[model samples]
Target: MIQLIASDMDGTLLDADKKLPPQFPALLEELYRRDITLAIASGRSRTALLSLFGDLAEELIFICDNGACVMQPHDAPIFHNLPDQTIRDVLDLCDTMPDTIPVLCGFHHIYFPENADQAVENEIRRFYLDYHKVPYSALYQTKEPILKIALCNMHGTAAYTAPMIQERFGSQYEIPVSGDYWMDLMCKGITKGAAVQDLQKQLGITPAETMTFGDYENDISMMECAEYSYAMANAPEHVQKYAKHIAPANTENGVVRTICEVLGIHMDSLRKSV
Candidate 1:
């Protein structure tokens, strides 16, 4: 029996417009009734996820910052900090890449350069709600350790930024192309898959009893953590290669539809409940 369901947010669970489906709240109720736990795993920060889910955030687990931080419901967050020198090295690299904007992700705050372009800052605000514009040095002085470093390139990260990052830091860190415009860097062993394994061990839920859905390169490791892994139809062909199954596109409420189908919850009944 499936006991846990973990899903990626952007491109997997959220629609093209980045909005949650209207039936999602009701679906959560159904999952709760069946004693199934839901985890939102994403490159997004904890503050962003909390704001997105509001009150319901307290009930769900969050694998945030590309698994650099994991927060269990009602528990303190588990953080994996990047070494101080590593953070400085990445920032130095970003200095050479003018088009890329680096966002330093700490447990309590997201920090970006005060001189970043306004347009880029506006775009980043959508995912990083609790953020500050400060010198990069401030990141090192913070009480909360830096957990992840996210580089954003509105033009496209996969084609440009990601390749450079991979060539320079691939062996030293876990760099995942999180989205068309974003790539994330974390400690070597930190990944969505590792976070899922930790959760499974704590909850006594095995991979065989877990289900996961994702649509990006960063989600690849996570797909391996579940026996019933699903890649959204909209996911790139390469990303889909990691999944065990294919589901409808996120625009079609694929996550909800697949969950109902796998758990034997009738779609008609779900719609009625909504």
Candidate 2:
């Protein structure tokens, strides 16, 4: 039997508005009742993640910043990567590429260079303000431990920022793309998939007994590793390439439908009554 279910946020779980569906909270409450472990596999920073999860934080575990940090409710973080010499290597790249805006994500806060442009500021607000204690124009040297570093095109010209990041930091970091405007660098050998392996071992479950859902390139590792993996119907082409199944779109309550099907809830019969 499947003992856990993990899903990505943005394009996978949350709708286009970046809001979780009302039904999902209810769904999770039921999952909790069954003693099933639920977790978010996301590219979001942990602070922003907590804000999004809010009161439900107790019921979930987090694989945050594309799996750079892992945490659970009322606990010290379970897994974290410390930035050492590599951090300086990444920062030096930022220094050389002045046009490429870099956002440094920490466990509890985010820091960007003081010279962040208007577009960068707006993007930060849109993505991080709700959850993070943001420190703008604040990165001094690469001395602090960072979860992930984001690189975005200043001119908004790099069509494939994912590959571009690989060309730049591929040797030292694993660069994964979550969307058109963002590419995240996490330490090598660490990813949502790796985190799942860790979580599974702790829970006494095997990967074959797990299922996952995601809709971004960053999610591909988990999707490829899980025995049963799904991509949203609205997922990007690159995302779909890795998933074993294609589920309904998010707007249509696709996740709920899949859960009901897997758990043997008769959604069709109930829907007719409603």
* Clash list (residue pairs), candidate 2: 113-137, 114-137
Cα lDDT of candidate 2 equals 0.76
Candidate 1, 174-238: lDDT as tens digits: 99998888899999989998999888999999999999999999999989989999999999999
Clashes of each: 0, 2
lDDT of 2 by residue, 1-274 (tens): 7788889888778877888866666677677777878889888888788888788887799999888889877878954654655666666666766567677777767777767677777777767742232333246453456888877664542453545567877887787776767778888887998898888888897878888988878888888767779999988877788998987887766777887788776665444433
lDDT of every model, 2 decimals: 0.89, 0.76
Angstrom error of the Cα, residue 179, model 2: value is 1.1
Candidate 1 TM-score, true structure as reference = 0.95
Each candidate: RMSD? 1.6, 3.2
**TM-score for each model:** 0.95, 0.87
Off by over 4 Å in 2: 130-138, 142-144, 154-164, 266-274
